[model samples]
Target: MKLQKLIILFFFILIGFAGISQNIMEPKDLIPANDEIVNWQLIDSVNTYTDEDLYMYINGGADLYLEYGFNKLGSCKYRNRLASKIILEVYQMKNDAGAFGVFTINSSGKGKKIEIGNEAVQYDYYLHFWKQNYYVRCASTVKSEGVIDTLQQLAKQVASKIELPGKKPELFVLFNKTGYPFKQVKYFKGQVALANIFNFSHGSVAGFNEGISGKLDDKMVFVFSYENEKQRREWFASLKGKMNMSMLFDQYTTVEDGFTVKDRMGIMLSFKPVGKYILAIKGMDWPEAQPVFEKTSTNLP
Candidate 1:
């Protein structure tokens, strides 16, 4: 009986150690001391949520985090001398790519980008930034120099505490920057998101593994990478076969290996195959698109 009891005790000890090690990467070090900042005080205590549990905080948006490999969410509220309050939410995604995914989803689409963490953006009342695997948000009820300053100070402090590799996705660099700038680029991994943004072969026909889009002066540039050449050919075959029989518009002009279109209202879309990827430029002038397509094609694997 004593021997059996000893074995059970050993097993429990091992389990306890495993539990502690599992949480070693969590942002336990991000909590600010009571007097850490001069003008702000913690509303109560730093709160934490995980995965589906985040629904309590965000009724309809928790699913988006889960889709992007959300790990944990650490949040806190603060109040100032002027009775204004700020809500700070720090989301720890699975990786830098996933962090950027959530960041792009929440951004206002128009902000004066700043340099606080790896990539920081500011709005009139709040700030959102991502560093490594963390995407953080700070929203305030009041707007003033003091509010922005305090929020930034806290962000910088927390940023210093979070420890992780600061590397962005490698695929992001493949996007041609001819006329596209920082704000105009977006990376997507799932078909649902792609369909929602720009409906092409839809959620299934495209068979997209991952893709990136950038907006130029005259057109929206879309590049989709499939699993392999076989799948790419399959999807392209479907698109090409429909070129002649289908009627989404009245004007269909065949380019090198792809086709171009203009609707009754004069909207244009052009498609071309580049290596194992497909480049689709909508509202593009045929001649101007050639050089852009060639440049992007040369960069692909």
Candidate 2:
């Protein structure tokens, strides 16, 4: 009887160790020397009950919880406790540009936070890792304090594991000379979106709208739809009388199909007051002034 009892106790102990073995560390758990580029340091480890909640304290006295399954705690701190119930999965990834290394993180939990000062806001981060890349994405209102540094370290670790693909080159430029200094803007789809910088100057800005309409800053002033030369000539004749001297150039350059590089007829009218100009040149190199004029007469614009 005594021998049997001892055997049963040993069996239960072995089973318990086996259940937690995956979360336990060994000498090999230390990142290999070559992987040192990631610079990950082990912070802490805990074997909480599978259903227990993890708490995190946020900046503005807010509390959060991580719903759990299998969780590994690191040196990173959270503002609220994490509840164990919501974690769906966790994994890793590698960078393709030889930038970062492998790191471990978690995912799929309810995100909550509170606002800090006007400048310092609170945010939540979702941790994920792939073969050679480690990404911590902001999923809530809180922001990560040292995100760039963490990524840099991870990049070094996975440098050798990255496999970058081929890339194509593209060019983009913005043309704005509306008296107001042209602020830098981005191109999305085929449209240009402008923002007012709240400057005191007030001479209206102008630009082509769609392909058939013209807009004067915030107002829509004219819409044209001329299909033939006779109709275009009549439209121009009528427009010439209504337009201000400054807008005459734009009117002359505007055509049924839109402005073209071959047409330079509008250049004389388009030149600005201070001699500063916006020229749309299309070619490997700029063409001489005479060719520009000849092409302008032959082209529609």
Candidate 3:
């Protein structure tokens, strides 16, 4: 019985070691053979995990990361001779757009933008940046001399090890800019992302590879690309039938192929398909919205 127990314990130990090995990541090697400080030490280890294992690190609000095609994550932290610590978390997403999604969601405030990777927004104590499929978050709590510069240096070192597609989504650049504000443009994929912000249709079967939305004056405008023209036509056909029929029982008048459907509270919405994409201009009367949507359509590819 004692021998059997020892064997079982060894087996479990090997399994535990395997699990530990899986979390180990290698961002890069920036350590020197010796430090300037007489008794300097380093506390550094690379840890990697998947989106499913994300909850282990972050308690809540992880669904958004998963929705954006989070694939893997690598974390690196270490201390310098001066006892200053730097921490960085690198997220490898599915594609460039996915990385951009993470960057877009986390990027706030009027932080200084840098040319680090594709784009990087820097803040006082931390920074969030992305290039290709990697979104990196680096923060330094140390208020030591040159700590900020050291953090940036470490960010660049890690960023160099990563690869970049050097490309943005094709549909991402198709949004009309004639009337749309440059600062308000948003590019996204997946239906949930749309419903959360665009609210175009709930659980619409349409699968969009990518889409863009922006403000056209006081009204909101959106452009979505389908897999192909066939898919686009199918969704449009189904949408047209419901829209045309919905206006029948309400205060709606057909204009510009689409109709002015008024809600019970009397809010009007206008939507029209331009080329392979759809155009929607909401929060304005049909008579005034018709010309704007038409003008907006001219800018669509």
189-237: candidate 3 lDDT, tens digit per residue: 6666666554443444255666766655556666667767787777766
List candidate 3 stretches off by more than 4 Å: 1-44, 77-87, 140-151, 163-165, 176-181, 200-206, 216-219, 236-255, 259-269, 282-301
Order the candidates by TM-score, highest first. 1, 3, 2
Candidate No. with top TM-score: 1
| Model 3 poorest ten-residue lDDT run | 29-38
Candidate 1 structure quality by residue, lDDT tens digits, 1-301:
9999999999999999986455335653575655887788889888899878888878685777777788888888888878889888888887788888667666656887888778888888889888888888888888877788877887888777766536666567767434346345767777655654566533433666777777665467878888888888888877766654455554678877877866445768778876678887877757767877887777777
lDDT of 2 at 289: 26
In terms of lDDT, model 2 sits at: 0.25
Off by over 4 Å in 1: 1-24, 176-183, 191-206, 237-254, 262-265
| Per-candidate clash tally | 0, 50, 0
Which 10 residues in a row give candidate 1 its minimum summed lDDT?
196-205
User: Which of 2 and 3 is the better model by TM-score?
Assistant: 3
Residue 7: error of model 1 in Å? 30
